[model samples]
Structure formats: C-alpha cells, structure tokens
Target: MSNTVFCKKFQKDMEALDRAPLPGAKGQEILQTVSKQAWQEWQLLQTMMINEKQLNLMLPESRKYVMEQMEKFLNNEPTDKVTGYVSPDDIVEL
Candidate 1:
C-alpha cells in the first residue's frame, strides 16, 4: 500500500495511516480516504467533544453523535465547537 493518500479533509495528498483506526467499513473508509494528520486532528477533536459534552461511550446515542461529528469533520462541514478550548499552536509563548 502507498504511504500517502489524497486526504479528503485537507483536499490534498498527505501521509496515510498505518492501519485503520476503527473496525469495519467506516474504519476502512477512513483508512483509504483520510490522511494521518486529519485523523490525528479528529482524535483531538473527538477527545475534546467527549470531555466537553460528557459523552458516555457506553451509550449508543453518544457513539452515534460522535460518528456523525466525525463524518461532518472529515467532509469539512461545520461541527460543534469545543468551547473554551484552544490549540497549543495558537498559544503564544513569551
């Protein structure tokens, strides 16, 4: 397999993930279309969403919500923003 993929999110070629992040079709789709950088970004956003929304992964609804968000994110659509959160790169060091 090629080490690069045409990332759907960034709309450019980028490094591909070594393996699918999840199981089944969705994971396979992501592995094929989503770049490693985009996936890593999604992971960060997913963590923030889980923490901010107090999502219980044990619940089907929560998982579904996350999945929906993931789709939107990968498609470059608007998603629920994690309030009060800032990226480390956005932080200015003195």
Candidate 2:
C-alpha cells in the first residue's frame, strides 16, 4: 500500500478509537496509540527542520518557540488542561 493511503487509514482508525469512551484496558490502548502518533509527529518535525532549509528561514524565532511549546503539550506534559484554571464538578453525592 502507498504511504499516503496507509497514513490516512491509520489516522481515521486512531480518531475513532480516541473518541470512544473506553475504560481500563480499552482506555490504555487509546492512550498508547495517541502517544505513538505524537512521537511520530515529533520525529517528522525534526526531519522537516533539517531538510526544509528555506521553511524555517520564513518563520520567526517566536513562532518556532510556539511550535516547540505545542509539541511539548502534545507529548502530555503539564498544560492548561492539567493546570486547573477552572474546575467543574461532574458528579455529586447528596
């Protein structure tokens, strides 16, 4: 199969899996898949940075920093989601 076709199918499968409310073993599978995709994207970015000489030349340093921060967020480090700017109670015991 062609790389483009394979990637598209994989992406669709991943999106479906991520959206499902799977718990325990099922949830772990989704997390693992997402993490693997994130790692793959990071590797792709490093490749583009090295190969696309003119691409980086067009973007500012601040833009590059923002992209780096975004990559960190995708890798699951602390972000707004975990920082707890606001909390909503989903369940209550009366």
Candidate 3:
C-alpha cells in the first residue's frame, strides 16, 4: 500500500516515499513528508550539480555539499542551477 503525506515542498498532499533516502533523522523526515516525485526531481538536480561542479563523491566535502543542497531543495528553497549549461533542445541533433 502507498502512503500519503502533506508534501512540504510541493505544498499539497501527495504520496510519500516508501522509505528514507538517507541514514538519519532527516532521511526519516523526508520519507514521511516528501513525495516520490519531488525526490526524483531532486535526484535530477543533484546529478546536474555533480556534473557542473565536477564533484568527487569519494571526498567528504562533495558529499556534504550534496546533502546540503538536498535539504534546501526538499524545503522548497531555490537551488543553484548548473552554470553555462545549454539545454538539450539548444543542441543540434546531428
């Protein structure tokens, strides 16, 4: 069965994530409050950030930065977009 929650990010009631995405209280909070759609969106943004920043996930700082961004994103705060990235539609598909 699916669970529903008042998703703080989307500002409406929606289906919640099946489980915590991380290992602590914050993760539990997200599982209870964030929707699957919002989490997926964050994942895409996180990927963009990793690429734009050339973050080495093996390093602690990179992981910390990612977690910070995730928190902000889930809280409905604006996140930094990847700078100078051209949208795929702008690229000539040759």
lDDT of each: 0.96, 0.43, 0.89
Report the C-alpha displacement of residue 63, candidate 2, in angstroms.
Answer: 0.8
TM agreement with the true structure for every prediction: 0.90, 0.26, 0.83
- Models ranked on lDDT: 1, 3, 2
lDDT of each residue in 1-94, candidate 1, tens digit only: 5599999999999999999999999889999999999999999999999999999999999999999999999999999999979878999999
Q: Candidate 3 lDDT (Cα, whole model)?
A: 0.89
For 1-94, candidate 2 gives per-residue lDDT tens digits of: 2111112214433322233223687445445454445545544554544354334535687457545644454545542232222234654567
Off by over 4 Å in 3: 84-94
Poorly placed runs, candidate 2 (over 4 Å): 1-13, 16-59, 79-94
Which prediction has more favorable lDDT, 1 or 3? Answer: 1
Sort the predicted structures by TM-score, highest score first. Answer: 1, 3, 2
Q: What are the root-mean-square deviations of the candidates from the true structure over C-alphas?
A: 1.9, 14.4, 2.9
Question: lDDT tens string, model 3, 1-94?
Answer: 7889889899999988888998899788888889999999899889999998999999999999999899889897877778867888889976
Candidate that scores best on TM-score: 1
